[model samples]
Target: MPEETPAGTPEGTSTARVGGTVDVGGLALTRVGFGAMQLERLEGDRDAAVALLRRAVELGVNHVDTAQFYGNGFVNEVIRDAFGDDDGVTVVSKVGATPDPGGRIPLRLAQRPEELRAGVEDNLRSLGLDRIPVVNLRRADSGPGLRAEGDQVVGLDDQLAVMTALRDEGKIGAIGLSAVSLETVRRALPVGVVCVQNSYSLVSRQDEELLRLCVEQGIAWVPFFPLGGSFPGLPKVTDTPEVLEAAKSLDVSPAQIGLAWLLHHTPNTILIPGTADPAHLEANVAVGSLRLDAATLRSLDAVESRTGDIVLD
Candidate 1:
C-alpha cells in the first residue's frame, strides 16, 4: 500500500500554502478526488471495480464523484459494494440524466423537475444512501455533452425547486451545478450552490471567469474532464508544450503537471480525475502531492491558447 495522509482536519485557501487537502461544500476533501465514471467498464468483474475503489480510499482519497447513469447503474452498484458504513468517502453525484441501456448514448437528459427528483432517488437506491453528501444538477445549457431540447428544456428555477425540496427533506446534503455558464451560476447563487463541476484545465481556460467567481463566492470548483478537450483550439493538457516541459523538469509525467497546475492555480480548485486501471488510479491519486515551483507555475500560466470568445480576467 502507498503511504497515507491523515484524514484529520486540514487547511485550505490560506495565502502561504495550498495543501493537498481542501474544505469543499462543508466537507473536507483531498485536493485530488476520485471520479467513478470509468467504473462503467469494470461491470463484468465488479469485484475489480470494488477493489479499485477500496484502493483509492486506502490511498487517502475521501471525495468520490459518481452518477446514476454511469454503466446503467453498474457503477453505483460497485460503489455501493465498495465500502463499509464507516468508510468516510464523500460521494457527490450528478442528476439531469437517466440510464438508457439501449440508447446510442447511455444517458438521455432527465432535465424535467420530476426526472431530477427521480434521478436522486435512483442514485440513493443504487448507492444505498438516504442522503448524498452533494448532488450536482448538470444544466446541459452550455458546454459539451447532452444538450436539452423541446420539453426537456426545463426552467432552472423549476429544477432548483425540486433539488431544494430534496435538500429540505434530507435526501441530499448540498446542491452543486455542472456544465453551466457564468450567468447560469450567478442566477443560481440564491439557491446556495456549494460547488461547480465544469470542464477546466490548464490547457482550457475558457471557464476562468466562472472559476474566479466560484473562488470569490466561497464555492468549491471541482473540475470534471481535467484535460480540456471539447474546444477546437485548446490542446489536451498533457499534450501542451509547457506542461510537458514542466513535467520533464519536475521529473513527473505531463499529466501530473497538468493536475498539479490546477491545484497551484486556484486555491479553491478540487480535481476528480477518474480511471479504471489500478496503476492509473494510483497515479491520479498521487497527484495530490505533486507540487510545482514558482518558475514552472509561471511557465504554465503564460502558456497561451484561444478560447473562442471568452476574454480571460
Candidate 2:
C-alpha cells in the first residue's frame, strides 16, 4: 500500500474506478495503468513529466511501466521524482537494452549475471527505490542467452537464474519478461515469473499463444501498445473494420474501443498506454467504462490477424 499523500489531480478526472485490479504477485494493480515512455517526447521537461506521473496516481493509477532506456533514463528519473515517497505505486521497469555512447539503442543484450546485476542497479538508482516491485527482463531481437556466442542462442534458464537470484537478494520483488515467446514463458515458469509484457493490441495478435499461457497460469499480461502505435507499417486501430464499427456503435473513439476490447479480451490483461497529454491520459483511463458486446467481440475476433507482419518497435 502507498503511504497517504495530500496531492490531488485536476477536478473531473475521477478516481481510478475505471478499471478493476489484478494481482501482479502480491501487488494488486489497477488493470488500467500508465506508461512513462512518452516522457521521452517531453524533451527533458522533468517538471511536466513528474506532474503527469503524480496526476496518474491521484487518478488511482498504482501501476507505472518504465525503463532505463526511455529518454536515456529520464523517464525513470521522473517516476522517482513524482512517486519516490509513495509506496502504493508499483513501478515496473525493464532491463536488456542499453543506450550507447551516441545515445542510441545498441544491439547489445544484457544477459550475463554481472551485466543484469548492473542493469538492476541502474534501475534502482534511476528510480530511487530500494527495490523495484517488478523488473522485466526484456528479450531483445538478438534473442536470449549469452551475447558472447554469436548466432548460437542459449535458453532463458541462464538469464532467469540471474533474475531469481536478484529477487532473493531483495533488489526486485517480481520477475517478468517482455517480447518473449510461449516457449520462454514455459521455461520461466519454475523461475516464478509473475508477469509478461508484450506488444499486443486490437490488431496485433502475434502473442495470442503467450497471452493464453499467462491467463492459464494467472500471470499478469501487460500489453505495451494497446492502441496501435503511430509507427510505420503498423495497422491503426481506427483503420480496422471491426474496431471502427464497434467505435461507431459504441459511440466512442476507435482507441477507446481498442482498449475496451483488450480489457474484455482477458481478465489478466493490464493496460499501460502512455500519453503526455492530460486529456489523453484521462481518456485512456476512462476506457474501462466502454464495454463491447458479444457481437462486437466476435467481429473483432474475425478481423484478419495481421500481427505477423507488424514488427516490434
Candidate 3:
C-alpha cells in the first residue's frame, strides 16, 4: 500500500482526508477515485490525457475503473499510455461487452464460458498488464427490456467457472459483478463476489438494498454515474433543489455534494466518477474531504421528488 501523505489531503477541504483509504477486494484504493470512460471520448490531446491521469495519481487516486468496450478499446489504450508502468495504481477493468465491426457497443451477451478467456486476454493486451487486479463480469442482459425478477442471473455457473479458471491460472486476482440486481448479487456471493458496480446516485436509489448488502458483507460497492450519466430521455440528478441547497450551505459544487453524500452514506462504497479534464479530475478527488452535516444529509435523503431511476440501457 502507498503511504498516505499531506498532499493526499488538500488544505481546508475537510478535517478528515479524502474518504480516508480502504482496500477494495484486496486492492488498496482511495474511497474517491476516477473513471476512465470519459477519456475514451477525447478526440485529440493525448498529452492532456496523460497529464490528467498522472495528476489523478498525484492527488492520491489509485483505483481507476475502465472497460475495453469504452471507445472500442481506446480507453484502455489511454490508460496504458499514461500509466502502463505505474504499478502503484490499481486498474480495474470489465469484461462481457465488445464493439461490433462499426465500433459500436451492441446489446448482446458476449461473455459466455468460451468467450471469457478471450475477454480477459483482450483486456490484458489492451492495458498491457500481466494480470488484472480486478475484473467485473458486466451482466450485458441486466439493462432495459430484461426482467430483473427472473432470468437475469442466468449463466452464473458458466461465468463463474471461467472466472475461477482464470483466477487459478493467475490472469485475474478478483471477480465482481456490474450492472446487476440485488438478487444477482445474492446469487454471486457464494462464489466469491468481491465487488458490485451499479449505477447509483441520490436520485437513483434502485440499488439501495444492494449497497446495504455490500456494506454488511464488506464487499466494495462501486457506484458509477455518481452525478448521473448522460442517458437520453432520462432526468438528471445534479440539478435538484436539495443538492443545490446543500451545495450552497456547504459552499461546494452540487457534484461534490453528491459524491460526499455517497462517501458519508456508506462505509464500503467506492466512487469512480470519470472526467477527461484535469481540473474536473482534481475537483472530483477533492470530494473525499468535502463533508456534509447530518441535517443536510437527511434533507438530501428525504427529497424524493428529485430522485430518479437507474438509466441503464
lDDT of 3: 0.76
> For model 3, which pairs clash?
203-307, 203-308
lDDT of 2 by residue, 1-313 (tens): 2121224633344443446678788888888889888888875577888888878877778889988878777888878878755448889998876765452224456666677778899999988889998999887432211133543243577788888999999999999988777887898898888889877787777788888889889899888767664455666777887788888887888888888888888888888989998888978888855667788899987876564343444
Score every model by TM-score.
0.89, 0.87, 0.87
In lDDT terms, which candidate is top? 1
Off by over 4 Å in 1: 1-19, 100-106, 230-234, 307-313
- Residue pairs clashing in model 1 are none
Tens digits of lDDT, candidate 3, 1-313: 2224355455544223446666666776778778988886584777777788888887777778888877778888888888855447888988876665442224344656666678899899989889999999887434432232333334777888898899888999999988887887898788788888887777767777788888788788888766764464444567888999988888888898888888877878788888988878878888877768889989988856333354444
TM-score of 2: 0.87
- lDDT by residue (1-313, candidate 1, tens digit) is 1113445534222111223566666687777778999998888898899999998887777878999988878898888899767998889999998877776555688899989999999999999998999999988866556678999988989999999999999999999999899999999999999899987777667888898898899889988768776444445788888988888888888888888888778888888888999999877766776767888888999977444442222
lDDT, residue 131, candidate 3: 93
Best by TM-score: 1
Please report, as a residue range, the 10-residue window in candidate 3 with the lowest summed lDDT: 144-153
Where does the lowest 10-residue lDDT sum fall in candidate 1? 9-18
* Superposition error at 22 for model 2 (Å): 0.4
Each candidate's lDDT (Cα)?
Answer: 0.81, 0.77, 0.76
